[model samples]
Structure formats: C-alpha cells, structure tokens
Target: MKIENAVIITNKTRLESLIERFNTKAQAKFYIEHSGGNFSDYEQEHFVFKTSLSAVVEKLSVHFKCKVIDRSYLPNYIFTEKDLPVVLGQDGLVANTAKYVNGLPIFAINPDDSRYDGILLPHNINNFEDQITRIVHDRFVYDDITMAKATLNDGQTLLAFNDFFIGPASHISARYNIKIGNENENQSSSGIIVSTGAGSTGWLSSVCNQVSRMSETETEIDMDWDEDQLFFVVREPFESKHSKANIVSGYIDDAHPLIVESFMPQKGVIFSDGIEKDYLNFNSGAIVKIGLADSKAHIIV
Candidate 1:
C-alpha cells in the first residue's frame, strides 16, 4: 500500500512519546486527538493536561516538519472520505467506528492494557512502533458486521452498531402498547429491548430467556424469530396488585409489526448503541420503528 500522508492520533497523556517515535522513523504528517475533558467545560479538572498537550503538539510540529491539529479538526481533516490509511488512538477507534466510516481501515493502538479493554485493537502501543511497517504494507482481513437502525416518531432515524433500548429514565416502570404488524399485542410490561446480531451477547442474552420460553411449546416457529434478526424482551410492568417487575421474551416475525407504548409518569429514553439518544413522551402515540442498519463495521483481525 502507498501511504503518502499518515495521521497519528493519540490521547493527551501519550502524545509526546508517539510524536518522538514517529519523528525518528518516518517523515509523514501527524495529527493528534487529545483526550482531555470536553472542550466546552472551561472549569474541567483536566485543563492542565489539555494545555500540556497543546504545547507538545506545537513543539512536535516544528521539530518533525508536521502539523498538529486538535480533536475538533478531526471532522474536517481526518474523515475526508479519502482512501488514506488512518492510525487512531484507542479512544478514537471506538468513537470513529461507531460513526460508520466506509473504505478506510482504522488501526487502533492500545496505550494501556490494564486501563481499558482492547478487543477491537490490532496492536498495542508498546510494540506498535516496531510493527508499524508490516501492518501498513501487508494485507489485513476485516469483518463486515451489520448494525441496527431505528426511526422515532419525530421521523428522526438513527443507527446503532450494538443495541436499541427503550425504558424508563427513573425508578418508575414504563408501560407501552406493543403491536406486531397490524395486530396489537397485549400491553403488560415495563419496557422493551430490541437488539441485533452483534448485540446478542450483551443484554440480548438476558432478554432471550424470557422469549425462549415461548419457543419450547411451538416446534415449527418462524425462521426470522431466530437470534439473527430482532429480539424483543419485556421489562417489569406496573401492576396495582403486585409491585414486582416481570420480563417476557419474544421475536418479531417477518413483516410483523412491533410497537410499544409508555404508561408511566416519567419520560421514556431510547438508547442507541448503548448511548442515550432521545427522550420519548408517553402522552401521544409515539411509534419507534426498528430494523437492520445499512452500514457495517469493518473489524481488522
């Protein structure tokens, strides 16, 4: 592979070491994404580290004949849809991968082994300098994994590489009406969780227990009800007689409708890919459509 311009991204703490190493071996341009506190918070505790990182970037730019840009410049510079190879810090790997970038292989360097889990990383920062040449020049395999797409009542659509959860934001239980295709299913649970294949190992496993019970009686179940498509699990619903949470598991068949309604006072929150996206009101008949996402994450092995 021919790499003319190389962008090196790193956290604030590891910027100096990475810059020094890059300057000694290669002459490619470098860029850093400092992992300081959010830029908006002026009184954040990590201001000192942010300032120190800025100073390091300036010094390295003059020494290595490269330009140093902040994390804010990432959208404008790093993700330009070009076919260039991008080396990212561990944090950058997770953040960017969630955004769904096509055609570019993002190589992540794990800075600390004990601090974080480097499940998606190709190499550790300790030995990355020595193996950098081999990785950039060789052929690597990446897995194309699908994501889940959800459309809210407001016509806003979002994609999740993991799972989509709809539940109460507080201690109160959430009540919602569920419909499969044109048939309105009985409402009896707290909330519902919908997950894709990649998310099956996460919360889906626990939720599957509730739905799996139904499969025992029916031998000739629909193939779409399998683990690959969508899994629906109900949470604890409000009951006047009994104050306990109950969960039920089921899958949405092909062309079948799946919908939920909230019956509690508290607001319902929808989490996409484990991150909170929007707050849903129960007053109106808000419909949330869930399905498979178009893009996939290319995981380099």
Candidate 2:
C-alpha cells in the first residue's frame, strides 16, 4: 500500500538525555563540565543530529505529509494504513523500530553517515529524496529481512529484528528445559540468544567471537539476513547432575526449532533486540516457542 503520510522515526541524542536528567541544556552542560566530562563533544553530536534531522524532515514534508515520532513511541502509536515509516538513526534504532512497524516498508535513512556505518540504514540525507520519490510512485524495491519470534504458552507472541534473549532478567542462572528435534535437556545457563539472518552480526557475532577466543570448539556462527532458518545459542550452559550442555548451539530450522520451558520460579524474561524494557514474562510455567515470524521486515536496501 502506498502511504501518503510519512512517519519519521528517531531517538533522543546524548544532549536530550542530559537535558532530561538535569532539566535544561545549561544545567546539563554545567553538570557534565563539573564532572570533568566533555560537554563540547555532546554539544557537537547533538548539533549534527538535530541539524540533519531538521533537513530530513524538511525534505520529507515537501513530498508527503510527515509525522515525526520518537523511537520510544512506536510501541503505543497506532500505525494507520497510509503511514510511511522513515527511520533516521543508528542500526539499533532501525532494528528497534522494525519489530513494531507491522511489516511497513522502511526507508532506512541515516542522518549522519560518519557516525553510523548504515548497515541497516542504506540511504542518507543526501540521497533520500530519490528514495522517497520512488516510494511515492510505488517503484521501490525491498528485501525481506527474516525476523525471530517468541510465542508464549499463554498465546502472547513477541517479534525480534535481530535476536531474542530468553533467560533471567538479571545476572543470574536461567534454568530451563530446552527441546530440539528428538533431544531435550534440563540446562542451567546465563540465557539463550535466538537470532535471524537480519541479526546474525549483532549479538550472535559477539558470542561467536568469545567462543572463538576462549574455546577450541568449532562454534561457527554465520547467517544470511533472509535465511529461512534461525540460529540459537545457549549462553554458558553448565553441566551438573541434572543440567546438561550437549545441545548448546545450532540452527532452528522448520523441523527443528528451539523450545524453552522456564524453570526459574521468578525473573525469567523473554526480550528481543537488546530492549530489556519491553519483554514478556516467562516464569516457571511458561513455554516459549522460538521460530521465524510469519512476516518479515520489508527493508528498502
């Protein structure tokens, strides 16, 4: 559907955060300076982002009716049928915005090319006018980025752009019964990270790097963004009398996916893309079904 209204998604910069904490820009600068922090650095970054945002918004307003929303408002904002989402921030912002967009084709716009590598963000302020033109004419092409999903036993499901973390909310051992194919185990680990091709490099790469450095096991973690299957990693599974660590990491294909039953009496959580605030409860009786979501993110590459 071609949307006439564009929704520009963005997040607060460091300066906004500082002002939120101290109630004013002057107080924020005062606090930072008194604490020996580089206030000028914050000012420069904020200026760049704000200036870039103004330009992007101005360009977008000339083409379509634009509605700018903070990244935090995505969860509650009801997206209309004619809403066009233009994400303007870091890769994390795109990933964070992707799950809530309901499969709207995203125009990933990077406000500042120098600070962000634009992995998820392919377009910048210098060239987004063309992308918008293409989008307006329904001539834009998009890639179907695979997404990970976690369905709770109570029928609640959560979507992830990059990955999903199933474990304790705090720094504690997460006890769960993991099932895959004909194998199952009662394991005690930090948690499990389930990722799609879109999120292979985000947290999964870090886990792979740590494994590559610390161990001799050939725990290869590689994924294409549009792969049908999902990859899962059980973080630091410990071997004990009842807990096992054999089925540590593998692919979660159609036939074989990860099923984790929470054994933690409390504090068990299921969150995605590193957003700990937005999560579903997974207590002792919860069963989280991990697999690919029915809908993929249509990202304009």
Measured by TM-score, the strongest candidate is 2
Measured on C-alpha atoms, candidate 2 has an lDDT of 0.89
Best by lDDT: 2
Predicted candidate 1 versus true structure: per-residue lDDT over 84-149, tens digit per residue: 333334443444454444535555555454455666566554554444455446556565555666
lDDT of each: 0.51, 0.89
**Cα lDDT of model 2 by residue, 43-94, tens digit:** 8888888888898889888878988899989999987769888898999998
Clashing residue pairs for model 2: 197-225
Q: Report the Cα lDDT for residue 81, model 1.
A: 37
Off by over 4 Å in 2: 216-218
Residue 278 deviation, candidate 1, in Å?
Answer: 6.7
Name model 1 segments beyond 4 Å from true. Answer: 1-78, 83-96, 100-104, 126-138, 181-183, 186-188, 206-228, 237-247, 252-257, 261-266, 277-283
Clashes of 1: 10
